[model samples]
Target chain A: MKRIRTAVQIIFTIFTNGYAYGFLRGKIYQGNLKYACVPGLNCYSCPGAVGSCPLGALQALLNRRGFQVPFAMLGFFFLFGSLFGRFICGWLCPFGLVQDLLHKIPLSRKRKRLPFHHILKYGKYVVLICLVGAGSLFLFGGFAKVPAFCKYLCPSGTLFGALPLLASNEALRDQAGGLFSWKLGILIVLLILSVKVYRPFCQYLCPLGAIYGWFNRFSLVQVHWEKERCISCGACQRACPVDLAPEEISRSAECIRCGKCAAACPEGCLHFSKKPGPNPDTKPDLKPEKRT
Target chain B: MNVMNQWNQKGGSRQHGSRGWLFGLLVGAAFLCIGGIRGELAVIWQKAVMICMECIGIG
Candidate 1:
């Protein structure tokens, strides 16, 4: 099933990316399924998407079209975030899988993020403000365009989401201007570096990751461990793809709850419980690990 | 004794959890807001939300 899902992931990503890049990135796909909601970070602009992407929907809502709150998208994210946290970052995201593959190269010189990068992570907020603030202004301004995020920054949309589609569509290619070129160049750099740098986009610039990460600590889905049961061997922390210290914040919103930590626990000390479950997401072992 | 201790522990846990959550939330939210403001992370959030939804679904 995992292998099949992985294959499905690739197929959906490649297909959607082809269509998004070639045919419908800047333009919305008129197809019903394309406008329908899909689960992962597939672009709404991609021709294969049936529903709109929540981020795109959020940006659209940030613009305050007809006074809608993007309830579907917002609720969707909340329900998902509250349940799985960063689990999405692990098993599902096409981009994430891409980064994992990149990390497979053994010869790359690895570098831990700089101390100042903690500050740099804040840059995603600026990106959000500019996109949402400016995008909303389209209501009154003459320069209204597709939300800036899609146009400027998203590598998934550019490389895996948009470029393939654009390559097949002459109209899109002919229409390719400075903006498209600029977005493409950005994607090229990020894609090339993601393997070496360990999801630089997610670590540094992903506004969505930032948002979901905020809710990770309190989200209903959480990881709890019996610290007393823990041998302090550090296996869970070492298994984390993001290099986060899982033992420190097993329930951390920054944690995708990928279960890698639990899977890696040599002592079988780490266990997960649902929020409605007993005092989970903690390092204490009182009675037992009650499965939520 | 057990009830009193549980209450105290709960209080302490809430306090600590709130602090950790607040710190993470503030930092993460700040990054998101800043990224949104800069217009660089427009699409990442949408895709992320969708991915989060699917994650919870299958998870």
Candidate 2:
């Protein structure tokens, strides 16, 4: 599953940003194909990115020449969020893929689960609503030249877009100043955190994940629970890379739908349910069938 | 928990589940409709064609 997921990630990364030679030319792709938006987060400034980043597009809408509300971009967000939920984060996002790979590096301390991790899950939603949603309209609406998130915080812009541009273009180095250093600092911190934590950015910062997570309750694709299956041995929780409980599989907004928990269940109690189950109870251990 | 249950009671899990796809379709259709009218595709195209130097922090 990991192999397949990695392959899918690679394919998506390539398909979205395939213009590899653009770095050498120090030119971004200026083709008509740029109009479309991909489901996952990829920087619009990425020389190879064929599609626009939704966050950037949303921010772009705020300062657009004619002050349009960007219904089309919002529509894309609604459509993707409602359909697949965080499945895009699990399987498609290049940034997610990078974090997953970074996490594989050998750590002797055995990955300390942050104490307030679950509580921090709500942070992404705040970022989505405040930074991505409102900040664009308020700050950028005032004719602030740059989108708030991209200019201030997005590490993907720094890693995939800015760094590559800086490396290839000699003239760009002289232009680097306080903001570049600040963004680079953020990118470095996130890179180190990715090594120590499982998708730290996805858990606490990604606005895209926050949007998709809200749709998880309603998404057609979700992890199903089989109440009648065997013992509730804590294997699934132990196996979960993101450390999600088996019961919280699809119910919690934190679930990435990575299928690690389903694979680790010894009793085969968990499976991806296309249709929603009738169970009202959210807790796995308290289920009536398990009691019986 | 009472408030939560009341919220849950308003929509059964099955109905809630189905609403997911229904809402998705409706929103997707709405986006396409508005996009067509606003010529949002052109907006996206124009943004894409222009190098966002500010995004890269060069400007």
Candidate 3:
């Protein structure tokens, strides 16, 4: 299942960024497909990107001259969030794949949670509300509006959009200045942290993840936990990359639906299901067996 | 008690059944149609086709 997921991630990444000619010529694809927004945190400026990024589209809509509600982008978010929630983060995001691969490297002992993980996870929400929401809507320079998150924070843009563009376009490289350096520095730190942590960016910084996470409890696709099944072995908790407990597996906003917990379950209790079962947060009457 | 036990004891789960998702899908579709009618998709196309300098952290 993990292999299949990895294959899907790779294939989707390639499909989203499939315009070989754009990469070769150091130009972005100016196609009709750009009208549609992709579900993940892919960069719109990526040379080969076939679709606009949802976050970028939202920011652009908010930053427009006339202040209007971003109904289209909100619709896109609602539609995607209802369907899969953060399953898109787990299986579709190119940056997630990069972080997954980086964590596999034997650079240091892999940690499940970062320091102050509980408090720090809320950072993504702060970023979403402040940078993507308020910064785009309020901050302006005379006639120009700034997409604050894209300009300052989005490591996906730095990695997939800027680096690829710079590598192929000498003009773009020559134009690189202090701003580019700052973004690059952020990208470097994130990439390095990926080796020691499981998706630090997704856990702490991604606005898209913050948005999709809200729908995890109500999404069509979901992880179902069967309370009747015997044995509350800690395997599922141990296997969970993000440190989510068995009870939290079904409804937790942080769950990316990677299926590692389900796979790790010794009893055939935990499973992914489209059909709704018992409420995820319902506690079992059976007590957990004391481990010697 | 372990962290899981502590969390389970706290028990503040909000329940939204299958109807919730169905309603969400309908709302999303309706909003999408309205936005399309307003030519918001064309705005997205126009913005996306051009190289976003800010996206690349350049300008």
Q: Put down candidate 2 lDDT per residue, B1-59, tens digits, no spaces.
A: 58756655665555778677677868877986797588877767777677676667765
Candidate 2's residue-wise lDDT over A89-163, tens digit each?
A: 999899999998898898634453666876887888888777776666666433464477777788888888898
Candidate 2 chain A lowest-lDDT run of ten: A283-292
Task: Give the lDDT ranking, best first.
Answer: 3, 2, 1
- Measured over all alpha carbons after superposition, the RMSD of each candidate to the real structure, in angstroms, is 10.0, 2.7, 3.6
TM-scores of the models, in the given order?
Answer: 0.69, 0.91, 0.93
For residues A186-285, what per-residue lDDT tens digits would candidate 3 score against the true structure? 9999999999999999999999999999888778888888777837777888999999877777768799999998888988788888744465556565
Q: Cα deviation in Å at residue A258, candidate 3? A: 0.3
Q: lDDT scores for all predictions? A: 0.55, 0.78, 0.87
TM-score of chain B of each: 0.38, 0.61, 0.71
Clashes of each: 46, 1, 0
Query: Which docking class does model 2 fall in?
Result: medium
DockQ winner between candidates 2 and 3:
2
Residue range with the least summed lDDT across 10 consecutive positions in model 3 chain A: A275-284
iRMSD, all candidates: 12.1, 2.1, 2.5
Would you list the rank order by TM-score, best first?
3, 2, 1
lDDT at residue A208 of model 2 (Cα atoms): 88
